[model samples]
Target: MSAFGAWTTAHGLPAFSYTMDQERDPRAEWDPILEPPTRRHAVHLGNRRITLVADNYGLSGLFDEHTALRWLTRDTGVTRVGELSTDISGSERIFGPTFVIVRVADDQVSLERTVLCPEGEAPWVLIRLRVRNLLGEPARLTLTEEWAARPAQVNLISGTAPSTGPDEDVGLELELIGGARPRRTGSGRLAVPLLLAAHGERVVELRYGLLDDTAPSFEGSLAALRDRLPRASAPRAPEAEREIPWHAALLTGAACADGVLGGHTLDQGSCYSFRHGFNGAARDPLQHALPLVYIEPDLALSVLRNTCAWGSPDGDLPYALGPDKQPWTDLFRPSDQNLWALWLAAEYLSATGEEAAFREPVPYHPLHRAAPVPLGEHLRRQFRFFTDVVGRGEHGHVRMLNADWNDMAITESGVDRELMIAQGESVLNSAMAAWVLPRYAVLAERLGDLVTAAEARKLGEELRGLVAEEWNGRWFRRAYGPGAVVGDSDMWLEVQPWAILCGATPPGRAAELLRRIEATAAAGSPLGARLRWPVREHHGPGGVGTIWYAINMTLIWAAADHVPELGWQWWRRMSLAAHANAYPDVWEGTLSGPDAYLAPETDRPGRTWDLADLGIAMQAYPVANLHSHSQPLLAYLRLLGVEPFSERAGTGDGARFASRALTVGP
Candidate 1:
């Protein structure tokens, strides 16, 4: 049995726990057995930001962009019956919504250490150590805490940066409460002595404050801050699937913050290679907020508005927003960024039924300084940009500016990037636009915008027709460019399911394509579907022998209606439990996983995969809280038939779009 399963059964607590007792391969340079399993949670209040990471051992690090500090060593000294000893037993970790509890127990005493980063602008993380004397006789104990400051780069590129910086002097303020006065043992070390009666218990609290310009001084007691911490509720699911949504919310919630470029924005991810805090992606927040629409509608709406605010006056959206909210205009030049706005707007409206929100005025990008326009106008501008500015190619498909949803699609060998950008067309984006544009038109018509509604429907129909023409009798061609047609011989998993989901494929053809996908993409994998069959030898990232959560989740969404059993099966295969089971010794895949997983065919099966040209050796990024979490949660909801965009808006069927509100337990 897995450590989590054993822990849950032993404690009978409705919490998720993972123990690090599994043996790993000795040859692996990064040993999961010795390395601590870490979880990083972000606390953002106004402009101040602090990220705290607690591992199974204890509180590991507290950091921001400019500061990083962690406990170097924790030693416990216990004297019982006039005998002094210095030894500690192994530890077990339990993960709560906003905190982690690391418990260490022995014959003499039981020590439970809880680390919490409370929400709001407080610049401190609270550490509570509860000690209970297990012996019948009185016990004298001393706890020594040692801390050191590491280079800030250690935390900065905790995401995907190539290297770290030199160690620098960073200051940390430690305030202790309810313990004997700490004696200075050595530089960056303190020893606290405590006397306990027979079978007595005592609690010690430490507030580690960050010394940064953005961080504000603590105004209340640590207990008060703990009391004020927001309580989160997890959505109800079957016992087997319950933890999925809970952990999804926990990770995605850590990526979100207020007082960003746009109010209530979400970052791409929170830790490891995914750590791009303060940097926002236009497509990521939309996908991240999809599941949130059912859990937290108001927050989801705010995210939608925030994403809309990232649009320029010319209706062009940035691939990403940097720390200062500056647009990274030329980053990959993805053509599908603007289309996501329309897709999300449709989902938001269907889920909330808030027609009036479309009329609310929202400012354009701060770079433009343009007058605020209605939310509906922002979406219309996006539609206009695609239909008028970008326009269709000779084949009537939408223009692929550098790339589409597959950022690396145009980067394959022998393909001229410039030529592809100038004339390439994305069938995937065309299919997506075909699916979303009509739905958006339905919304536009409901808002009494007849012209836009008609225009959207027309373009959607034209794109659908163009996409259908690219069908290669087996699966739809991936894209049209200077190089050989992508996915012509080998089926590209990304676009095939989309064609079915968007209703572009005929009913019979959709079923045929799905069956083919199951036989090729789905059948070849032990954990979820593969990106393509007979893996591409000279392909870019995501081309072959990889499974991206975002793309496969779409497969689940599409299969839910047609292949119900396959949908659930594929969903389970992509789940955290499945990854944990497949790679019990890999810490990154045990608790959380990367955005994409390398298939069994790859050199490092069950590990993370990205940047195919860089080789698999360089792309095994550690697990980070990413939109991968949100995609599975959203797909699960879809599998449960909780679709927000099922009903066609403004269709003469007289059926109003309806949505079921889902709430997490508190």
Candidate 2:
């Protein structure tokens, strides 16, 4: 790209887009119109109609601020803007009823409220207009009072209590334990005939103190007395002269960490990809996968444990799992999910020393990083699901089922096991075997269970041998599905040859995969290529690629560990390749492309967890070598190293170069 293009990339500015709705509508059903400036012109509100814009994007739907992915990753630093400031009462508990904050990148919103009568000295509640423009257009759109909230709050689900079924009045995720009749504050929406547009922000806000409390239930202490959280402050470039380095570091870290999670989870995980053609936006797991990696180690371990528990006595993670918990195969494939998550888990465990954290239990609360106490047995079982059952490799060669990351639905019936393997293509289960066996071996030995340790090592060796034998030498097969065999070299498959089973791949094959990756045939990208074959299958709306930042990071790390000589080059290549998500929280995957779409998990019912693990991908950057893969990596790569990446190249080097450019007191 050009210097201007490079600048646009580093700063989260859009490079190119189809400006008109007509051009946009033909391709995607649910195209993500992220910039308030770009989409506001297309939206119109009818009387009494509030079409939630954020809901379409995997958020939890509590206030505009609540998101599905972040809920699970709550403990991680990636979170809502409201979290950064005080609520109305100046307390964490009290937040606005009118609007809610999502990621910190969304620091402010432009609220449109109609000034009301009885406007005394206090005039009910003081309206705060929060403006945020994702387009990098330098200005806040100020919406005069058009609506207000007595106790402002975006509509969000509360508590995971048993649902009495879907009711229009109550949120599915939220629960009002005791008699809780939320007050009626006559909160109104801003009139729409007067459609106004800021260069970049859509007017959204919250309200409070405009009316009297209608109900005495649900404890005012928990609801009314909680101090209001301060609104997320807008960072003015001029005023932020000193904070640039800090913010830049944080923003870059968020992006790199998320890159490690490429193609991991099925829910929101499916939404990540880098295909720039037809299947450009095909849903996969990587998007939020890695962010979750860094944010919560225990959570990542739980996911691994689940994968391990699923191993069919013979060892194989299944194709996929329905939100309802049914097994799915034939749709999306989990080739990398099981393995990647497992490797990430083991690697994370080693770094964080979160064994005690894992003993705590399941339901794998994405929101909380370290559970206070051990989780119950039932929860543990859930965690062990992937570790213990799904694929046993029973009838055939420790075969695996063919299901994509989401594993929710692919419409398969009377399915048996598949027996196809290809090189440069470390299938999901195989990847799992490589990542888990070593750790399990160490763990089993520590517990003094000789048999268990032996079995673990046996499993690891068995997988390593199988991968070397099955992979078609150059590339790996897509799946062990019906008759079709996708034999092509994919970049994602490149990592296992190195990162897994203590580098089981032979020197020649390892070099081949690295070369393919560097050449961009396997993992091509303006930023980075995706492992997606049949780019013809690029998913959803637009004509964008499936590249995900998290996946790129994983490949780079694996290369650093295995290829060594070539690792730094790929490292430099990838370091300059991340121009996707503009939320300050890395690209969920190349965002500008028409392909980016919501993952199946985001479409699932009830509350959901965001992919905070992706936030940790950056932790591996500055390693002198691959001494520590998780925390220590994070410390050196993201926080410790000199500039953390491409140290020899120095500052002001490339377009994507995340320059600290500052000296901080912290």
Best candidate per lDDT, number? Answer: 1
lDDT of 2 by residue, 1-666 (tens): 211112221112111121222223332222122111111111000000111111112121111111112211111111123223211111111011211122223343322221111111111222223334444345423232222211122111121211223223221121111224422223232222123344454433223221332222212312321221111111111212212222222221121111111111222211221000011011222222222344433334433444333223223334433322223343434433444433444445444545554454333222223232232222223224434544444322333434433231122212233333221122445554655566655644543456756866777777666656545665544333344333333323323433332455666766676676566533433334443433434222211123333344455555543564444443333332222222122222211111122222224111112222322111111111111112112221322122111232221221121222222212
lDDT of 1 at 125: 59
Best by TM-score: 1
Q: Which residue pairs in candidate 1 collide?
A: 159-272, 159-273, 233-665
Looking at model 2, residue 563 earns an lDDT score of: 60
Model 1: residue 150 alpha-carbon error in angstroms: 4.7
Cα-based lDDT for every prediction: 0.61, 0.29
Q: Give lDDT tens digits, candidate 1, residues 575-647.
A: 6667767766455555555667777777667766544233222233455445556777777667666665663
TM-score: model 1 vs. ground truth: 0.80
Q: Where does model 1 exceed 4 Å of error?
A: 1-16, 21-50, 63-89, 119-124, 139-193, 209-240, 270-280, 482-484, 538-540, 610-620, 647-660, 663-666
For candidate 2, the 10 contiguous residues with the lowest summed lDDT are 40-49
